[model samples]
Target chain A: MPALANLTSREELLAEALGEGWRPGPPPGGEAEDAPPDLLPKALPLSQVIRVDYVVPGCPPPAPLIGEFFNAFLSGEMPEPGYVFAKVKALCEECPRTREERVLKKIVRPHELLPAPEVCLLDQGMICLGPVTCGGCSAACPSAGMPCTGCLGPTPKAGDMGLAMISALASLVRAGEEGEETIPKEDEILDALVDPIGTLYKFGVPTSLSPLRERAGVRGSSSPYPVPYQRGRGGEEGGGR
Target chain B: MKKIVIDPITRLEGHGKILLYLDEAGGLKDAVLEIPELRGFERFCQGRRAEEMPQITERICGVCPEAHHLASAKALDECYSAEVPEPARLQRELFYDAYIFSDHLLHLVFLGGPDLLLPQDTPKGQRNVLGVLQAHPELGKQVVKVRARAQRILDLIGGKAIHPVFALPGGVAQPLSQEAREEIRGHAQAMVGLAERMVTFFHEQVLPDPGIQSLLLAEECRLPTHYMGLVDEEGAPNFYHGALRIVSAAGEEIYCGDAREALSLIEEHTEPWTYVKFPYLKEFSWQGFSAGVESGIYRVGPLARINVAERMATPLAQEEFERFFDHFGERPVHATFAYHWARLIEMVQAAEDVARLSEEDALTGREVRGELSSPGEGIGVIEAARGTLFHHYKLSPEGLVEFVNLIVATTHNAAGIGLSVKQMAARVVKEGELDERLLNRVEMAFRAYDPCLACATHFLPGETPLAVEIYDAQGVLKQRIVR
Candidate 1:
């Protein structure tokens, strides 16, 4: 927040060009003094808490779209309330990779291997969220040789992004662990899958109907300090990250 | 007695604050630094997979995600006991070079630079990056553009410039194409040129000013303590990969070891007033907030790296390194303000080395990632732009993360930062009065460390957003200065 060369969300080009974005961090550890003791709060997107008038596409809506919003505001041509300022189609519409309509035999975690650049991440066995996510980021992550983690939020299909992703993944992956190349029985892929909830609901959980119930039970740690997200939360000393 | 509060806070208490207690004669009797917020991260990171850590943990701070990403990847490597391929190491290091280059340039030109670049008496509002840019548009614009170009390199490789995702256990995810390497070299060459010009700017424009001279000679914030940094095999300071090295006030070696062994060498002590824990060398034990070779107090970041290492890893930086030592005429430079100069030297090193790393023949190889085994407990350490960053994890048999601990750069420098604040406050406060000078000196004192204050400033509307409230012995408000 220093004054020197301080660039806001508007000024940073990567954010504008690619819709570069992030998820909400955990709630602050300290709370308001006058808050009710029974206030059991779980992290939820603001749209869920209130009647959202209109949705801006990206986590931080990109510049052109922001410009569109303002132009609409100035010209009094604003879209109907409750509308999303993004494409109705899925993020796959913007993806540049090739999709061969192939079934996946194994699940490849992000770290397992170098993803093939020209092939679709989903087609290459990575659980890319492109099919379920809203388009607008121009497939930035996919183009950079990584899978989409859905920072642009859900499409306007009025369905949970994670659940939709789970259904899509179930259809593609076969029943077997990694390194197995055999054709497997139908709908048996669920047995081979692990951490479905984590992989699926990473960003969408805040807005998902099937939000994590385990978060409540997992709220406090045995250590009492509950130093969760140590890397993200525990940073900012010398350079003030 | 009088109490002067720098950044008096109530609701937004997480930002850095200073409490100066003054005697009747106006000399400070005692001083303290307070930061009032921290939360639990270990609780949430436990149930996740280790492979996702580089991506997840990088979200902790927008400024230094690349540091966390690389460090987490290294910890994952240790957890799985994978020997990384030479090509992957080159790729990660090359990526890290751009990160350090960009980050250091940010601090020197934008955050800390504004203070030194402008005159001491410059109005608070005009002393920021905007003020500096308006005054020297060419220098300011060029630095900003170059900084972005460096991020462009990160974007090309890390997949996300701010939140890099290239790193994974044993290696990186993205393989550099021949085209990408060539592009990186072009940008890095431009960056190297800019860094050298800035170094010249530091000499001609900054060093001659009496304001800077005072800051350089100021005894108030001089802290004589242990220094910690990462040193390469040749004992050259390296930001990406090296063993942790700790040296004493008189330049004596104390401890040199890998990240896991570092866990044993250091101990954490917590205060009842704050959640922030003070870490000290376990060998000497915790001996209060005072600093010295005998006490466990240790400092990190640019000054520490320069002090702890034998030489800089690159040529131009090594030249500046020799000049830095000659300027001090001492084994270790303890002057707090010297950190600014040291940081510029580091920037020169980062920019110069980025070009070298870009041209490495192994940079574009196909074996960018290697296979790994089952996860276990492991530790990883790297020098973040701020200072040394530590990440440790323990995994279950199912490969789910079980335990997590991190000693971030801020945590590493907490004790020293607090001590410096107190020292600067005591030196500047005269006769129980709150004035402009106290704000300037105190600001520079902590800004030396480039601390990430958790406090929100936008809520307050003023030229200087912070309000320093002075109170008497009876806890009555004596005077309030908003600057």
Candidate 2:
């Protein structure tokens, strides 16, 4: 049971038969490593090695948080240099917006709400991502205290991800048969993204009614929601609608 | 005499069923598993909110969605008492080692090497993954280049690789880019030379094939029972998050703690024929059985995590774990074919601790996270790839998450793997022989416990034909059904 040319490399066989600790580059940066450049984006690649077009988020992001964001760009700490999708387009300048309400309705479900710290969840009336998203979630859904499930997917001024999820579900419905300054309709953005089709397709992204069914060029069933049941049986229950 | 059924077995991810029976002195009696299907994701995450359950329970497993986003953000950072910062607990153990390196490279290249490199009566259009890329095309291009370098470390910390959303509680809401740590340090040196050629193609082309080592050295197996996982405070093998121990068959350490007292010794009943529920071990819920060896709930996964680890801090996986403490003695190795030698010594201690954290220059970082706060109940256990997966959650003094239980390691070996598949289908089939391919090779050795079933929900529904009765050595009675 040996020969596949006797095998070895789990790092040269645990670095020469397992003393195995390791550290050729990157560590030091965490306690907000001297704050200042807070708004994010230094794009290190461990000491300027390259390929910085970044976006990778969704939770499993750890390996010591990419080795402290590449040891804060190998210590120069350059965050402001832009294009990490423009620091998630300056999360709509710490968002708060209601600027005399842009077409209202009555919508909630951002995990139901209560905490609202720096405000904005679609301008306090809820449905938020602080004005069309991106700000490295530090504004953590109005500041932890919960709501921006954007999961940091889209934010270089939201050009797409289904037009900022149809402008955050036409700013969470209620505008009525599309009027009070428009938006809402298309069956109220399919009832604000069908109650969460597993958090609107977890992180696969795509949405905005999948390019309006590929700009009306229909292909059929791309799951604009529905079909919740069926998953690891034994304790069955349902409801996505 | 012959009756066997596979039901919903193909390409393993979820869904279940296995049954087999026989008698009249020809031999082999009964065995049933059934798990019919009902992912009540803990009653659809009861009443929701617990930090929106780590992005709604990372859509519970498209095969270990980062173990339901690290047991739902460590049960909403323990139901919101949220401390979470030592750089968000070392970036949640480096994205729980890229969710245990793309779920043990998608179960050794697409669910247990397509029936050990395509054959066991092959034809199902050459048995899948394009018949493992036309039989080992360089192990299917090194299993899609070690799952695209474990999907660039799950797309640099949960943006996506299947279902990630940067597990948040007091940290990780997307933060890591030194150009995604030099493309995860050049895909961790090409996944340490494709995990040493997949540990030499799992010990030479799938454990020396004689139909896969006679279902991995079958000595009328199903071992000494009772073992569980997620160790750590020194006990070793801690997949991510810890506590919950339990070990016995003499290795000792009977039950450790935390994981919300995993419903005080896991129970879960119901079996009006099977949507898989059984569970057991509430002190062997009325134990009654005989088979030549003592049995009451034989355990599961990584041999219940190296028999509930009390050691192993990595020195070559602690010298290959002191040769399994003197090769199973004081009543232990009751052979459930040593769950493939405890899944190749926990896949060579997860490829030697992911090549010692990919030669750590602290694995490149940009201050991952901090400041975490807390508002109450929390739990997170790990060791996934099927086994020890707790989660718990409770929260609400304003933090949100009201409740969510979860458990799941196939509901703690569903009643000791249905009493060792009814004592190995009553000692290898014969009595009125019903063999749906030897009960789907005894439910692919109880799917080497890769069971998730969206983390246990307790139960319901059943009765889809599958009958099989037998009794006779003058005890007369027979019936075999699948239709």
Candidate 3:
């Protein structure tokens, strides 16, 4: 992995981001034609932008975890700044599903399949992000028969969640392909994945490794999303109450 | 002309600003509510799977995510043309009842209750749930216990307390185990007893309060509008699913049918200044916000539900229901403050249903899911914690969402809330005499509706209260009143 320290110069970074010879102040045209009013186009993650002190992971930070945080807070025994007050494990570890068949034969949308009880949703070809998501929610969605949407952000070991998931999915598909006689190649199953970005990078796209992802039939931004950062969780649930 | 802006922008989900235009004499001429509309929700859900909607749409509001989840689930059921099994329906209703009990209790004890429980002179910081708790610690403790119990039941059945993920196209995700069923029964029976205690508190402490009485009888608080809610075949309040019923201001049945026809009956009127759209009956059309037979103005909430339904399904609630109408000595109580009182009445019914549905044999049945046919256009309507919530979707043959439209409880009450604020603003915001108490009176007109727009129910400390800025015609911020 490339060190973030290696990419020090903001000018160089911005130049690379906008174009090879790009400068600040919206080009020679004097005004940015961009539609979305992102406070800072080059906005970094919370840790990157400023000094941070502790985090309780999970979309809303589950009740039990919050209780733990409050206890630690009141006692003045807060852990280090980088310490996230949540289970430091993948969601799949906590998921109560039997994972005997760690293989993806084919991809299926949520409506196309009725997930079997006590079986891993990913094993049933549903694109659950449990393997790549943080475990603080205790596999809440998976237990309920819905695939995990990775709302707790990434787990500690799962660096670059989308890519980590891709690697995991490839190996899972390859394992299935090794036994299937009718299957020509792993490409058949891999190609069947629908709405790739929406499914995989649903939560972390704003601060993603590569935010400006371009594809065929993509919009002007290669994504029409104006959800800069705060509203980045388009499925903005689990806050306020 | 002077303009007064009441900006309640503290809540993160959404912010609303009320612009009160005053004439030279300091008399109110017009009022407009400017709230930021969350755009792109429809577009966001467009290419997503129809089955994924229940999870996605629930994020619209933190306060009533369950409402969105169930409405989306039912809509998906319609899209797939699935006949949800009796077991699943029973489970859904049971879950809904618990939700209603919890949510209504939340509004009663925390949101609207404080306004009446505490004195008007109470400090701005203390005039909320904290003050209510300080006043009645035992009641507060009991309320907290019941709320937690209800939420625990929600977590068990819906899979999580806040944004539930159990509902699917044809039915719920999993069958209720016998253990969970018995657990729900135990919790629900306790809640029923607690609901009755709530009424005892209401009659003992709330009804006789002189300030509350004046607010109830206030001229500005009255609006004779059409009432809408869901009713069972027996014409009783059924929160989960039922035929749509609309009763006129004069206590006559205006329309009774399913959601599709109800959708056709109401038309949305939009304005240039605010994203808040006014939904009114199409029969009378948009007749300029007045409450009469000629205007399309209609309301949906506790007051509307009770007015539209013939009686409460449960006996205890039915008895309270009779006493409620008797106290008013009227059919459709036009007093807007009655919403708070009516909310308590509904809480009784919700608790009763929670206890009753848990005893149903179907609730514990193994067959929680039914078969689905093909994907198509569908509309689902349910009475949310606040009011009638609608979720309409058109799915592609492959089950991807082709179209999406959602009318949450707040949207349905937009026009009524606007008019209520306007009327109150006219009475309260006098020329050269504006105070925080007077502005709060205007806000009282709003909070009574309990329209949890932008998840406005929970207010964290340090967040600004309803701020009023009186501006001259030239748009200079002249006098500011903030709490």
Candidate 4:
């Protein structure tokens, strides 16, 4: 038999059926000449026209898990149509790091210092989203000596992985300490966050509690975060989180 | 006359469609393969820390994340003006070989094997890995075992089987353990055996079948286009380190040397219907889409790599390379199906290189990093499994990415695939006598190229199913095939 054909968008399908002179409408509010086409709208629209079967969650699901899914499918043991996921609820459950509660005096970038192999990266002042992201990858990123950016998306209990991480970072910052005049201010703490949208919603923004448009409060805006970072500036105070 | 749209070409990475326009007399008028998915990746990369590119860019495509990761890392090295330590370079090459071996093996056995093993008219449901397993149970078991072993090697070197984070700006993030090195040596040996088995299988099973052999040599599968790839100092195929080489259709050397100069020799042409841009030779002056020798179109990947290289680096692969040339009758094999043959040869070279790298003591050394400096503009190029991949970035002095551009392997073959599809559609769907079998033949032309539209377009997860709709000249639907 021939190989499979392409999976077309709703617009392409409609245009093919409708003949010539049919073009898709400009995206809401005409964001830019080119923007990352939102996949949620394209993928979710199919549910209205056809029966939705199964949903496999992951930014890019692990290969072994995919193999298992295929094996189960080929063997006729696939479960009923719904969400099929790993048993572990959060990435922290699968992480091998030793966790401890301690307030951090400052935020450290991964490139600035080599993290210890055994301790929690977040505790080491590095921004790791394992606490709020889903597991099933066996903590692949952390095991590789890199912090997890939450590619597995938010855990079921978390409304938004980015917000949860922001909250986590805020609580971890040295705050409300008696007579600690050297404690960093709230703005400094927030400034250290760096590319907040990129960190928080790297993979979950499209399907997050606060979608891009809602968060930006502007249709077709490239950045979902309301706070804007000043470009070409050299200081920490130059850009806001 | 009619128009048929094969939307979302299936069994490959990402989303793309094939449009066939026929005249009222049922003669083929025009054919175009369009990529509709766009992630605006360059825009996404802008303003992000240059150091984070390796991690961020790998998420572009699941099939070849290693390629992106390594390419981005190399680009960062240049951006920071840091010379990578020797041991780190060795480790990176070793990790990359494992990736190439596993990726090529997966494509051959899981994706492209069924078309070679099963009959062309086999039912759609059985034209996949499951069917291949049922037909050749022992070989199927070996495929799984070999792929698992390859993945083990990746995990050992990079600390993750998928989307590895081992590469750093000037060096690798960690040193390889002695135990891990030993483990990899064993797996590498096994991979050599697996590669040998694949060669034997291709020669014994695929070549002997008259029908398949004829199809392999079919006119629809031939394209007299230029070939480009990376080659070592001795002009041998080098996946990790090499200079770019381009050879014309008639086996004449066109250009060789610096990748930047080579990149300057090409330009991209955009069509309003597709998001993916068509890259053609700048020397040809953007002549629009056309087929045959004068079209100024070129191809890159396994076949192109083998065509441009003087010989394979490893002994066994060199012998196989000689045999391949002897069979095909010369360099620059125009038959696109020969991509499979070329891919198998590269697999042998990769496995052998892995074994060679595993035996080296440098892999276990601790000096894996180099000092970093202020950021600047840089470019990284590599021979990914699909073809040559380029990642160019410009960073602010503060190390923030100011600009980004990527020309993935799939994009290089985009124009070539379009031409191949046109030729196949004209040959198989003559006079509007369309049928499922003929459509399969058209798809067969596409599969030979192994085009990964997802990587080309830079969007979403892999493996989207494809569907095709046939419309008459009057814009009335006739039939639809969902695979």
Best by DockQ: 3
| lDDT per residue as tens, model 2, A48-114 | 2333333234333324335545766689663443213223343455544323445445555443333
- RMSD values for the candidates in order, in angstroms, are 10.1, 25.1, 8.5, 8.5
lDDT of 4 by residue, B100-163 (tens): 9998988888878777877767788898889999988998898899889988988877867677
In model 2, what is the error at residue B405, expressed in angstroms? 27
The local distance difference test score of each candidate is 0.71, 0.53, 0.74, 0.74
lDDT tens digits by residue: candidate 3, A106-168 = 887666666788888888998999987767777898887789988777655565578879989
**TM-score head-to-head 1 vs 2, winner:** 1
Model 4 regions lying over 4 Å from their true place: A1-57, A62-90, A99-101, A155-158, A175-180, A185-190, A209-241, B291-294, B461-466, B481-483
lDDT of 2 by residue, B152-244 (tens): 676566655555656666566534545766666676656656655665666566656676655544565545666777777887877876777
After superposition, candidate 1 runs with Cα above 4 Å error? A1-86, A102-104, A173-188, A210-241, B8-14, B22-27, B453-464
List clashing residue pairs in candidate 3.
Answer: none
What fraction of native interface contacts is shared by candidate 4? 0.18
- TM-score quality measure for candidate 2: 0.32
| DockQ, structure candidate 1 | 0.13
User: Which has the higher DockQ value, candidate number 1 or candidate number 4?
Assistant: 4
Q: Is the docking of candidate 3 incorrect, acceptable, medium or high quality?
A: incorrect
